[model samples]
Structures are given as structure tokens and as C-alpha cells.
Target: MEEEKMEAEDPNHNNWERRPESPPELPAPPEPAAPCRRRCDSSGGRALLGISGSTSKFLMNVITVDDYRSTYWPKLESAIDQLLTQSPGDYIPISYEQIYSCVYKCVCQQHSEQMYSDLMRKIACHLERVSQDLQVSSPAHYIEKFNLALGQYMGALQSIVPLFIYMNKFYIETKLNRDLKDDLIQLFTDHVADKHIYSLMPLLIEAQSTPFQVTPSTMASIVKGLHTLRPEWVQLAPTLFSKFIPNILPPAMESELQDYAAQDIKLQQELMQNGFARGDQSRKRAGDELAYNGASSCGSSQGYR
Candidate 1:
């Protein structure tokens, strides 16, 4: 009875005795929506999604090696011909910017090796032609022609090197560990200068020995030009003179010099004899004139007295 009365007095007595009601079941969470699928279009090769149309076209339309060669090589060849054939100081017919673009594209397309090889071959051919032309020149004119050709070729290279700067820096310098200009110069030396060096040596020696016979400027041009193409030639001239002069001079020039020296001595002695005879005659005439003047003065003074 005391427990019941206490329970009744408690405001929570019935609630404590009653079982707690279970919470109503919540509906299952809705399934997450599927991600929207973007199907890539497969026509005309695989299309790059999220890229601009121009970029996509550029990637898709890759230029094959053959295509590059076919489409651009003729243009390049023609331009090179124009560059090589143009007279010194003449305006270039081809556009430098256009060639630069083509070369840049070729290098970017990984065609540098082929392009470099073809360019070298073309240059070698041009040099070969130049060598043949130089070979046919008369010995008297050989140095002049060679100097002219060298100047023209080097001038053309000045125009060419800039056009190929991209390929030269990226492929020639980096991969081959060579300088483009040096390689081109070497080509000229090998094909043109070196081949003719032996034949040219005698003329060069003669010109140097008697510089007055040839224009000093012409001799200087040839020497400087050859030296530029082949630095070793500077030392070579002295070496050649030291080794060959003794043997060569006696056979060729020494006899001529001795003959001229004998003739010169005879002529000089004859001139000296003539001079002395003229001096003696002048002295005798001066004495005679003085004696006549003295006689004339004496006669005049006597007559006056």
C-alpha cells in the first residue's frame, strides 16, 4: 500500500510502467542519380573532348614525314636555289618568314634529322658544282674566281643560317654537337678549297713572292679567304716555302734572278763610267770659261788705263 501510494503520487509512475513506443520506420534514402555519360564521337578518328576544335584538328591532322617532304621540300629547294644563285648584294626572292615557319614546323614535327640531311646534301651538291667550275678556271684567274665564289657562298650562308636557326639550335647543335655554320664552311672547304689546294699552292707562292706582279689586294683576298676557310693554311704556306723553296727555286727562279743580277751589275757599271766622263768634261769647260773671263778682264783694264 505504501509503494502504490508513492507510485500514484509520482507523476511519471504510469509512464514508467508502460513500454516505450518504437519510432515509425523512415523511408529508405533515394538512390543517387547516375553520372551523365559523355560518349566520345568516333568518327574521323578519336575526337579529343574538352579541347577547342582548332586544337583538336591540329592534333588529328598530323603531318606525316612523306607529306612534309612532298608539300614543303620543293618550296625549300627552290628557295635554297634562289639564295645560292642570287648575285652578291642582290635581294632574296623568297620570303624569310615563310621559310622560318616551314622549318619551325618541320622541326616541331620531328623531321629535323631528315631535313638536316637533305639540306646538307643540297649544299654539298651546290659546292660540288662550284668546285667543278673552279677547277676549270685558268691558273691566272683561279684565285680570283675562287675568292669570288667563296664570297658569294658565304654571303648566301649568312642569309641561310638565320632561316635554319631553329633546326640548327635544336637538332644540329644539341644532337650532333656541331655548329651549323662551321659545318657548312667545312663543306665548302672540303669540296672547293681543299680539292684545289695543291694546284693553287704554286700560284699562291708566286703571288706572295712577287706581290707587285699581282694586285696586292687580290693576293690578300685569296690568302684571307683561304685562311678563313682553312685556318691551318696560314701555317701551311710557311711550311710549304721552307720545304719546297730550296728545291723549287734553283730549278725555277734562282737562275732567272742570277741572270738579272749580272745584267743589272753591268748596266750600273756603265752608268757610273758615263757619269764620271760627264763630270770631267764639265770641269774642263768650267776651267776654260774662267781663263777666258780672266783674259777678258785684263784686256779691258789695260785698254781703260
Candidate 2:
């Protein structure tokens, strides 16, 4: 009964909770299909029963990913180089399948760290060249050129982002990490956008306040583009819509004073009247209690005398 009560108290309890299962009865060993069988041959002997390459590798304990790393690393770097050197508006044909395969192999080989580091370095170096190519001496044209180069680079890197994320499903995402697109955005901002694009916010707002060389549409695009680079820092909506709050704090007594200010003379008079009447009623009640106590004291003293 106690056990039944305990089980009844447990809302999730069920009659068929899991327990150790008894071992199932095994079938008798099958008869050998082959005429002859070999046990562990070392002299390049034929496999006992239709052994494939992977099966042979498993048997011999020769399975390794060193060859995969060696084979794919150079190809990966070469594709990145092509991405860097390709001409403007000329789309270099990239074999996405091969790149994804390389990344997948690297992940399989437990070489994702090396691959990620190499990718960061290569992409950073290439982006440095892009930043240099788009450098402008004029502060006025700085935002324009940086933005243009940023767009071009992003367009170029569009094809490569998918391949970089091929390994994200298995390893990178589980660690609570950023993805390839986010990394690329960081690289671009660090190398290119941070210098010219992000620094223009106050200046751009100033210009928006007044007339400027860059048109309103271009300025809008600049703000939008900056948002794409760093979302937290870019809030052009308030600036664009002329929405602003003065930094000056309200007076300390503003809340109490505002209530008084909100009331007209007639309303204030009515409030004072109600408060005075309540106070008088309380005082009158106290006076009546005191008089009754004095009378009771006098009557008791006379009766005692």
C-alpha cells in the first residue's frame, strides 16, 4: 500500500518503466558459405569473404585522415587565391562540391582547427588587399569607396560561404559559435568597414541635418549598409525620422509639480475641501471620546465618595 501510494503520488509514473531486459536467445551459428576460410593472413592473401578497401583498412587498422588533409589543403588555398585574383565582374567558376568535400574531409579528419585558422588567415590577407585597393585620400569619398568595395567582396565571397558552413552542422555550431557569414562580416569590418564606414555615423547624421554632397538616397543606403555590418550600433531609423530625445533630465520635483499644474483652481479647491472635512471629522471623533472618558471618571469618583 505504501509503495502504491508513492507511485500514485508521482504524476509521471507508469506501470512499464524501463528495466534490465533478459538476454535474447541466440540462433545457432550459420554454416560457412565458402569452401575454405583463412584466419588472419599476413602475406597479401585474398580476404576470406569479399573484403572491400574500407573493410580491409578496418581489419588492418590502417584507417587514417592524413592523406585527406594533405590532398585537400593545397586545393583549398588555391581556390581562395582564385577568389582573390579574379577580375571585376568576371565570375570565376568555383566547384562548390569539391570545396564542401574538402571541408567535410577536414572535419572528418579532426583537422577543422587548422582549416579554420588557415581560412581566417587567407581571407584576412585577401581582404587587406581589398581594403588597400579601395583606400581613398578624401574623407568625403571614404564612405562611398569603402561601401563599394565591401559590396564587391561580399558578392565574390557569396559562393564560398556555403562551403565554409559545410562543417558547421557537426562541430562548430555545437560550441555556441558564430557561422561563416558572421565571421566574414567581422573580417570585412575589421579590415575595411570599421575604418571608413562605421566612423561616418555622427558625420552622416550631421550631414542629414544639413545639406551634403552625398544624396539622401545614398545616405540612406550607407546607413542601411552599416546596419548590415554591425546591427547593434546602427540605428538609422530614429536619426532618419528626426526622432530625438533631449539629454536634459526633468526637474527632481517634476512629478509632484506636474500633478498640481495639471489641476485647475476649481478642482484644487474641491480637493482641499474634501481633505479639510475628513480632518475635522477625525478631530470631532477624538473630542467626543475624551469627553466620554472624563464623564465616566467623574461618575466613578462620586459613587466611590
Candidate 3:
């Protein structure tokens, strides 16, 4: 066997590594993709007040406001229906955060007015349907059923109240001159509890026969809490001086006539009035029965007062 010849090399050469003829260069870091700008339609672009190009970028998944309205709104409606179900443990299938975010975006995009009107109409329609769907079997439980329906309806709407309030301040309070809560209550009362409230009206009125069960503070609260939405005049204080032909004044509050107006002037008249103070001697007054112009409270003031 022929002896293998050793190639000549310096001892230091072992320490030096041999380099490949051509080293593969690391690929240059890919140019950062241009800030993924999206071209949105007229309704979506930055030119529009609320929604900007940035919104489009963030909401890349959101096609357009109309698209959200068509798709997501229906999903929201489905969730609402689920909330309205009779099952006590029932919950909406859709994510609340996602729905709220969608609503927020829509409102922020200057689609607020349309969104507000649409929401109101949809809510009203649902309330009407709920009113019809409710079963009132026992006459005794009519109020109970009505209360339950109101509670369920309110629960279904509770999640959306924040969204409702967003437009309520701008649209309902300003343009409509109405309270959203009052409006919703009115709707429920009209559609669900109309008859119950009608029958229970006399119970709520403060009269000689029906003495106030609550304290002064509670009465104040009731007056403040129960704002009437109806057009008929509903005063917080029942006046004894009504049905004045020309000018009929209340009886003098003081024992004797203590006139604010001087007696000398032809137009001026001095008058004493009977005042009811916080611990007055005359706590009770006669003729307390409130005479309703119309017996039906179904057409009564929708508001609390």
C-alpha cells in the first residue's frame, strides 16, 4: 500500500478556518410595508369629520358604516333577542365589547344621527313586539307580569344604555327635548303596562282620602322622579285655587290679611294667603280627591309627574 503524502500546512493554519468561495449574504430586512393605507369610500375617508383614514387602518376588518349597519347591527339585534328570552340564565351570544366598540365607531364617525334614529326605531319595534308576546293569564298577576316585562325589557336595554346616552345628549336632549329614560319608560308603559297604570292611578295620587304614605323627602323624590311626558297639565302640588272664572285666589294663609299689594291703587289688591309649612297646624286639607278630567289614565301623562 502506498503511503499517503501529508499536505504541507503551517501549525497556525489549523487555527484559521477556511472560508467558502462565496458566502450567502443575509437577505436585506424586507422594506417595511408602506403604512398599509386603505382607500375608503366617501363615507369612510379622513375627509369625513369623525372617521379618518386612521380609523380605516385600525378598522381594516370593518368595510364601511353601511356594511356594519347591514351585518353587525343584525347581529346586535339577535343578541338583544337572546337577552329578551324568557330563560333567566340566558345571555347574548355575541361579544358585548365588540358590539359596543362597533357602536362607538359608528357614532364617532358622524353617523350618529342616523344611528340614533335607527336604534330608537328598532328599540320601539322590539318593545311593541315584546308587549304583544307577553302572556297575562291571571288578572291578579297583571301588574306582576307588567313589572316583569318592564324589568326584562330594561335589562335587555341596559347594556346599550351607554350607547343610547351618547346620542341622547346630542339628539334626544337637544333636538327632541326629551329624556331617553323617560321616553323608554313611556314606551313600556304604553305598550306593556297601560292598563295596569290606568287602574293604579288613584293609588298614586295624594288626596284627603288617599293620604300620602311617604315622607316629605320621599314625596319630593317621587315628584322629581316621576316626570310627566303627557301634554295635560300635571302639577306636583295640587292647588286648592283652581277653576277661577276671572281671578280666584287661595284663602289667606295667615289668620288675618297681610297684603303684599297696597289697597289704595285701583288695580292693586291686598290678599292674605293660607300657607302650609313643614309642620303646619293644618296638616290635612279637605276635598283631597283629585278630579280627573278624563277617567282613563291610559291617556294619562306618560311621565312620572
lDDT of 3 at 177: 84
Flag regions of model 2 displaced more than 4 Å.
1-70, 84-89, 133-136, 197-199, 202-212, 215-218, 235-305
Taking the tens digit of each residue's C-alpha lDDT, what string does model 3 give over 255-279? 2222311211211121112232335
Which lDDT tens digits does candidate 1 get at residues 217-246?
Answer: 666667666767876675666533433223
The TM-score-based order of candidates, best leading, equals: 1, 2, 3
* lDDT tens digits, residue span 203-290, model 2: 6766655444556566766666666677655344343422222212232353444343333334435647646332444556777877
Task: List runs of model 1 lying over 4 Å from the truth.
Answer: 1-56, 59-61, 239-305
Order of models, best lDDT first:
1, 2, 3
**Candidates' lDDT values, in order?**
0.62, 0.53, 0.43
Task: List candidate 3 stretches off by more than 4 Å.
Answer: 1-66, 86-93, 133-136, 163-165, 169-179, 199-305
For candidate 1, the 10 contiguous residues with the lowest summed lDDT are: 32-41
lDDT of 2 at 50: 64
**What's the TM-score of each model vs. the native?**
0.59, 0.50, 0.44
Best by lDDT: 1
